[model samples]
Target: MDSNLLRVPDGSESVTDADEEIFLVYTALNQKPTDQIGPDGFRGLGHVDSRKDIISIRFELTALSHPTSSLSKVAEDNLASKSRKGKSARRTCNHADAPQTIEIELAQDKTALRSRKGDTGSVLWRASIAFAQVILQQHQFPQSNPLFDKDLLRKSHILELGAGTGLLSIALSALAKSYTATDIAPLLPLIRKNVALNFTGWTYNTRLQEGSPGSNICVEELDWETLLSLPPARRSHYYPKPAEPNAEWDLVLIVDCIYHPSLLPALVETIETVCTAAKTWVLVIVELRQEDVVREFLERWLSKGTWQLFRVEGLLELPYVIWAGQKGVP
Candidate 1:
């Protein structure tokens, strides 16, 4: 269980109405500190008890599998088949082998899942899994981590840019107070499908350790091209607008979002808009598909001289690079 979900309460007296809704639901589900015991013999925290009852049903299908460095023989064969057919090569994220044993009922039409040539947004990416793993790690050690701010993540209005497969966003919904997952318009269908698939109707309300049901997760269309094309004054309107009026993003999660150099400019601009706010934080997971492209983005990013960037060390051996940063000088 993640204590981060239980770590921050009220999170300052200036809590917005949306935050109040999340906190109220969290309190209702988890219950207050009391001197009562439950019928199951264990005491306090109804959600924890709920976990005891649910573990048997939901986790039975989940297998404790480690991340794989190589694709399975079957995926390799699929790659070879696509190559032989002269079809554009697909970008296959390691999630195909990662711990997806939780039984998400995706569409049976496997053909539809295939990624089109030159468009990686339609497919999963390794950094998405890495980002989720990082979240779990922070939840495990909320106090020690220098890379991310626990309070910002726990109670803030959060957004995930290019939330491919909605993997990170799904995991985030259970942790963050309010999470909005965004991708291109066409991918919204697939993202929503994955959301519904992982979080069934009956279990959706009960899944998160915190946050109100329904308010915990939202899916929306956010295109970097379209957003960047908008006028400077109008670009803010393109952001994933929170239902709570006047809400600004406190944390932004970007997973494997920077690969193409052409999209880098817009992506960086979008990041600046979100992070320039006084207290916002951005956690980016880049899979370094191209060193030149990655370097270009880093250089462009540094040129602004605004963000105080921190490259998350020790994750170098992993499939992706983790970056945590916040705006400088407020």
Candidate 2:
């Protein structure tokens, strides 16, 4: 891990400087070999290793379509004050059209540093912040024009695979009708705690229980290997069927989950299972760390012949890339 990667920006720095500072935090992992990366452990987050501290990171949610800029100090102070006063962040936005800031409080336990594979979910990743920013700013453009369907998230039920710290759920969940965050068993508690930390009066059930009024944001275990092994007949046994019976998930998010090569089959299979409907959209975001690994995942995805892939060219400058896929559609 590069110690300078986490350098705090000075007050005199420009928005581009600050943006580059934060961007390096997540992209730093790209310098490492893909074989050395673990499911939950990212080398870039080395500072959180073996610690149990709750850290709060603030992301200035700006429009990717425009010249990117960080929020002004005055605006940030106002939002922080409102957050401290227990006010809803939605009410704190500058106006119907202005970009808003979000502070995500998360706990990271790198105790897995001792294990063969790391549990990296306890901390926030830069890719999640970038994705959330893109989501937050999508409304600025007409619904029909963005690379990601501007209307899909607004009116849909969203499911995020390998949600990690639940940052995306915490930041954008309430905007949708429903949002479900899923990961392996070990990371569920961290996701639930982080989600609860940001959302007042929200309680999460360990598993999506039967007939219980679904919470605004739900956290459930969705191990990819488990879903892949289950016969298609038994796949619905996984918690969180689409909000409507027999309907496919409206949107599926796969951000920064493409590191380990061994998990590619399981990951692709699970995605194919959930995104069965023609309208279901899968958004896959990966840091441009290892090109070969990323190419391999894309190859497997396209080889399936069921998904039609598309890219968001607007965000080409970012260290990560976004791909949108749908099944049985041209």
Candidate 3:
């Protein structure tokens, strides 16, 4: 809940202003100390800082779940009171009483799904459950559609749909000249926090080695399920005019957003309505779990030639499919 701002060093080319900001915000959220200087005199927590051009942020479980003074005392007392009848007894008691920390990185451009470790085939972790891991993964794979090409993105106006935690949007904001980021109303606070944390100290001087003049990034509440039926009063909260139709986005992005079978149709309808003819591309990156449901949805909607399916490599080395609109076809 608390936040802090740290100034980036001038001679530091290994990390950008954005990387430092994210690191600080993440450390604060996990309730960890940030002023500790490492052996190299640089602030060290858990991320890889070797890359001079790219800013990499690392998340560690120990940093996220450091035991409080009272909790530590209780654990110590419990361990001390255990009887040493035998090595097995001591080991068993220690294992039961020991505290475990679960740490993860938030590098993904979209912070909507969490990465899992081991073969613990229990329920898969999601963005809502592990915010840190999802962010980390999104950063590693910012784009869902590799076929779209970098040249296409350079010239197009982009929109990120269901932009949870605003990681992809932030990436797009850095790449595209104009970008609009939208998600459910409830997530705006986190999205804004992330945007501010990443962009506050960023400068766009041509001489700066790390980042270009940052893009014009704006975050708003645009519910894909609501569409034009959204209340005029509520819509006005983010948009300038609620009644007027706005044709602003040329490309739409949906990352890790296709789990619910019922929402696919509504989501498509919203895309068709908001995006104009100039908006010829839609990138959807999702980890296919329920193939039956996804196949049925794609066969019904994508087969119509309105959208085309292309496969892209995911950050976790998984296969992700991207859906783009046909030029002048839809």
Candidate 4:
């Protein structure tokens, strides 16, 4: 990892520059070969020998989007706090107490996005990209099949839970009839920004055949744990008031959200509530970590018999499991 990638601003402590740099390095090293080239030039050699029938390998790294000038001002404000005083302040001056700053490239893919240091509050998880690609592959959009096939992509209302940067939802929205992306309140602005950045100058009419309906995509604030707990009137406060009451989603997407042991039950409950009316398909994308927490959670769901889980095949460049679910109850 490059040490310069880890330099934080002068005074911010919420996230260290080192943290950003380390995350960037890990993401870059782990991305699929199609995504980026390795720092050492081992091009797309996944468990294969270097001398094996070597086709021409191309090395291309995505450009990182620089943060706006305003970020520097925010960094200054976060670093220049005069709260420290007296003897304790002197003890804290041993470098650890200084504010840390990291320069981040905005809107880069998962790999480059991790190197950003700021209070953006958006958490980028590698599993999300893996799952998103899986979903795209399953539907065969912008690749094998046509764009707006009603049988495959259209008329499917998709909802992305905890959509940190709304990447998956953005792709789905481009293919599906409608998409609703949600996350915690803190992440809404960043999600919207990402959506705008990717969708700018995007023309779907040319891609789709004549008479195919366009996609409708919107970002909203939805705390999954509290979604169904709210009263009908209160629900409107969080979600937009649908013109009709039967506007249920056809699919629900969640990525890297089941890590916490306690969160699984709440997450399942939230999925059950939101997916009540429609014959919904739930797509969960998760990465296998050292801990068995995720595996245990899946087992609990399996024992209940309310849901069916199938692990979809993934690409060599991505480390993700695609667990797809259908209507388990009626």
> What TM-score do all the candidates reach, one by one?
0.63, 0.71, 0.47, 0.53
Model 3 spans with C-alpha error above 4 angstroms: 1-152, 201-215, 228-248, 303-305, 312-316
TM-score of 1: 0.63
Tell me, by TM-score, which candidate is best: 2
* Residue-level lDDT tens digits of model 4 in 126-148: 44433443334334322232212
lDDT of each: 0.51, 0.60, 0.39, 0.45
The Cα error of candidate 4 at residue 306, in Å, is 2.3
Best by lDDT, which number?
Answer: 2
lDDT of 2 by residue, 42-75 (tens): 4233222234355555655444345231122112
Per-residue lDDT of model 1, residues 17-127, tens digit only: 323323433343345333222212333211111111011101111124322212120111122212222111122224423333222222222333454544455545434
Each model's total of backbone clashes: 0, 2, 16, 12
Single out the weakest 10-residue window by summed lDDT for candidate 1: 53-62
What is candidate 3's CA lDDT for residue 226? 68
Q: Which residue segments of model 2 deviate by more than 4 Å?
A: 1-52, 61-91, 97-99, 113-116, 140-144, 148-152, 206-215
What lDDT score is found at residue 163 in candidate 1? 77
Candidate 2, overall lDDT? 0.60
Q: Tell me how many residue pairs clash in candidate 1.
A: 0
What does the lDDT come to for candidate 4? 0.45
Give the better candidate number (2 or 4) by TM-score. 2
| CA RMSD, predictions in order | 17.0, 10.9, 19.8, 18.9
| Poorest 10 consecutive residues by lDDT, candidate 2 | 1-10
